[model samples]
Target: MLFQVGGQGTRPTFFEMSAAQQLPSSVRAALTYSLGVFALRRPFIHKILDYEDEFFALLMLVLETHSLRTTDASFSESLYGLRRRGAKIKLKKSNLLTNSADEVRHTGLRKRQKVLSVVFLVVLPYLKSKLQSTYNREREANLQASLWGDSDERFDGDFVTGDNNSFGSRDVSNIEASARDRCIKRVRKIVGACYPWLHAGNEGLSFAYQLLYLLDATGFYSLGLHALGIHVCRATGQELMDTSSRISKIRSRERERLRGSPWLKALQGGLLSCAYAVLDYAQTGLIAAVFFFKMMEWWYQSAEERMSAPTVYPPPPPPPPPKVAKEGIPLPPDRTLCPLCLQKRANPSVMAVSGFVFCYTCVFKYTNQYKRCPVTLMPASVDQIRRLFHDV
Candidate 1:
């Protein structure tokens, strides 16, 4: 009797395994296959379907308050179990098999599954991509605005009270500004949908983004000004006042456009001006400090050399040679020519240490680069050269 009971249990287990094998695969697999087929036919569909699993998983988590695996198991198993259960009901009602009730129930369940498959595989991805594109536009607009500043240009003439030329220009400016503002507003609205803090009229966030941009602009301007100053000090003798005035004008214009009350505007302007002044002063002071240090170093070196030199007394000179003047003989080659170029010295100058004559520009350039005399190879400097005036 125990052997017979075990045999019966084994028969049911075999039947169940057969039934499970006949059941459909998971809903996620079905959806993925459908999306893959669609993407193959329409290449652009791939963009939305690339993250199909993630999107469906997130949707399931939000709606059912469970993970994708749990939800998928429940969906696929329940649908297959329902069909099997309905078949068992039909078997019990075999006497009334001619009644069509089982067929109607099975048909309804199939229709419901079809609708669900369509929604998950098609509708959800389309909506998500649309929403994503809208938000993307807004983010792009915000980035462009921050980097390039506002695109709007102010019109100097009034539309209604101006002459034909002025009216035309004003109209054109207004049209351009309106188009640009419209685009910006559309993008901003989309961004605000995702991040409400970035919505229009959110003064705090807007001001913060603008302040960061201002700081970046100020830093770049300061660097450029510093470079210009160095160029002026080395190559040209121009004053910094002109550059300062131009920068002030630009700052004033920017401040005028900034959103603020008169007092606030004035305060910000003052702060920026102060910052610019500090930068200018720092650059100028650094240049002056370098020059002062160089002068002190030279003084110290000269003092040391003077103290290190030997003090020797020379013997008296012999009788002077007789003076002879003969114009017929060819004179020896002029030794005053520049050794570097072997040419008559133009703009003649003397190196203080070597007491040698050379072209002022040639020797000055050489010393400035190498810090030594061209002929004697002794240490020299451009500053120690004295311009020589010859009586022609």
Candidate 2:
């Protein structure tokens, strides 16, 4: 059975105290929701439009950190005030121990404090985890439709293959495939714009989480040390106030140096702004280079095939008999027949080096076998032959 405690002093009861202690957590939740829905969500519209999700997550992180620090400072101040008030009340109650009402009040306060501690430490964390789980589940369900498309509702079996369908079905399948690809692309863009850190595993307790926690822990540790130092100075009756003032002056000077230096600030800002652009350009260039090299490779393979292909030659005709000529006169040459085949020309072409016309097949076969022109016998190749437009 649970016991009840009643109090009528300056001290608050268990439920009231617990509610007061949870003020920071409540403020943190409100700030997170406000920043996420109002501030970060505004970027989502612009982010989706721009198709660039690179820095939105980083901005969200900065805003979240600022909100957490603000709430934490408030909570710390409130806790310090409560501790000081409690100490004062305890001292007064000790002097009034002879009063029965004072004794009862102290007992009730102690019981209430214990109950409040349990509620805040145990019950609150469990509730927070349950709420987070529910939120994640709902978010996943809503976003899933944007990724998988109507396929989830349509096909219950494996994808069809091997051209076993009618033309209409094939066209329908092609359209569905194209639609599915488009849906996947849209979903990727939305996810990237809304939550860049999701891919980087910073959505939950990750490096960013640990780093922020460490900063808070260090700040609280320093505060604890400062409090301890003050307590020690008071106990020893030492004058350390001047020393602390000097230290503060030094810190202020350092801060001013950091803040006032123009070059350092510019350098930092430039790095932050241009680092992602450089990385993205580098990635795109690398992909383009790979595709360009693949195209070049395919071009080279096609050229090699053309070069190695066998050239077909129609059966060579008998060589014509040399015409006898008078001592000082040369016989007129035949214009209708090819010099290589000694027959009627078929698909005549011309050699660039010797300017001699020959049949296309005859010249290609001769060049492939002998690599020389038939008339001049000069060094010639298949590439030097040009197809003639006129019939021989």
Candidate 3:
């Protein structure tokens, strides 16, 4: 399936090589993460004072509220009753019937009911207690229905849902400016600590996140936010974001600062690092999948004599075919599309790669070798100068 296209002496392309060619995907992904270093060149700045101001604003709102619960007592009772009766809302109809021992063979209804009861009695009301007036508004949740097929058995009785846990009612009303001061002081100390690259003088964390997000290289930045979000939520005895308007703002700004600090190198260095990271991700995804399946097999066999496997749903239906070429219809016209990102937009460069013209800027941003041709998935190189063809 893979034969080199260039001359014999030239090295084989990345796409042509097997995934064992690189570090394990998980390891590579971990290594690719920016520890506020080696990625972003130009950081974007935000006003941290805005976060401080909003925290106090929110604190006042909470203090003013006579009743923390938005809905009346009757409505609260109704919601509680629904939870007690095991009225678990499965938006996707198929999810309602999933793994039912009678049908799908692994619902674990009794266990699930027990979990639901704990959530309703202990967690649900506490979470509801912290909701802001706006949070009480009707909200729409997105659903992704997929089909999964796995050869592992360990996942048989496991159930997954978005509602993993609920928070309890508490006056996170206590999370104050002292907490804010301490958090900021701690970060300042950490960034300033004994690392040449992580110097606060060299990079602003806020700027780092913005640039990395712009370059689509936000791996650790997001993880940092999630871990910190959990940390803040627990420390304050309520949702961290609910502590106060100002604290919530600080939470956001904190994530922005911490995540952004990566890739905040001098411009050229940042761009090169981003290119390296993204290319690495695309290159390593396959290895991760294979390893995942292997792990599942090992776990399933180890679980018991015949434990059921994790239910992996099948992939959703394929997207409708493009309208560009209907049978027997003429092409509308040659339109410019982003040669790099591939998302068509206005003002694309009309340069050729593999005899097709594309936006030069798009191609400039796109990396070859690691992630090759957009359409064909073949190895690519820029053809800045026209190559001549002749009869031999």
lDDT per residue as tens, model 2, 210-325:
34434533211122212221110010112124333544575456445555378886776566447434432432443344445556657879999999999999989976643322
What is model 1's C-alpha RMSD?
37.1
Tell me the deviation in Å of residue 94 in model 1: 33
- Residue 153 of model 1, lDDT score: 39
The C-alpha stretches of model 2 lying farther than 4 A from their native spots are 1-17, 28-131, 134-155, 163-392
* Clashing pairs counted in every model: 0, 0, 29
Preferred candidate (lDDT higher): 1 or 3 = 1
Q: What lDDT does each candidate get?
A: 0.48, 0.46, 0.34
Q: Please identify model 1 stretches exceeding 4 Å from their true place.
A: 1-113, 153-157, 162-187, 190-392
Candidate 1 TM-score over all chains jointly: 0.21
TM-score for all models, in order of appearance: 0.21, 0.22, 0.13
lDDT of 3 by residue, 1-392 (tens): 01123322212222222221122323323323321123354232123222422432342233212111211111112112110111222344565567533221112124444433334323433333323211222111111112343313435675544554432222253366658866865654443343335334324774575456445354212223222221000012132234345444643463454433445534545565564454334323434544555575577678854566566899899765333223212322433444344455334333233344344454444533334344333445555413324211
Give the Å error, residue 303, model 1. 76
List pairs with backbone clashes in candidate 1: none
> What overall lDDT, based on C-alpha atoms, would model 1 receive against the true structure?
0.48
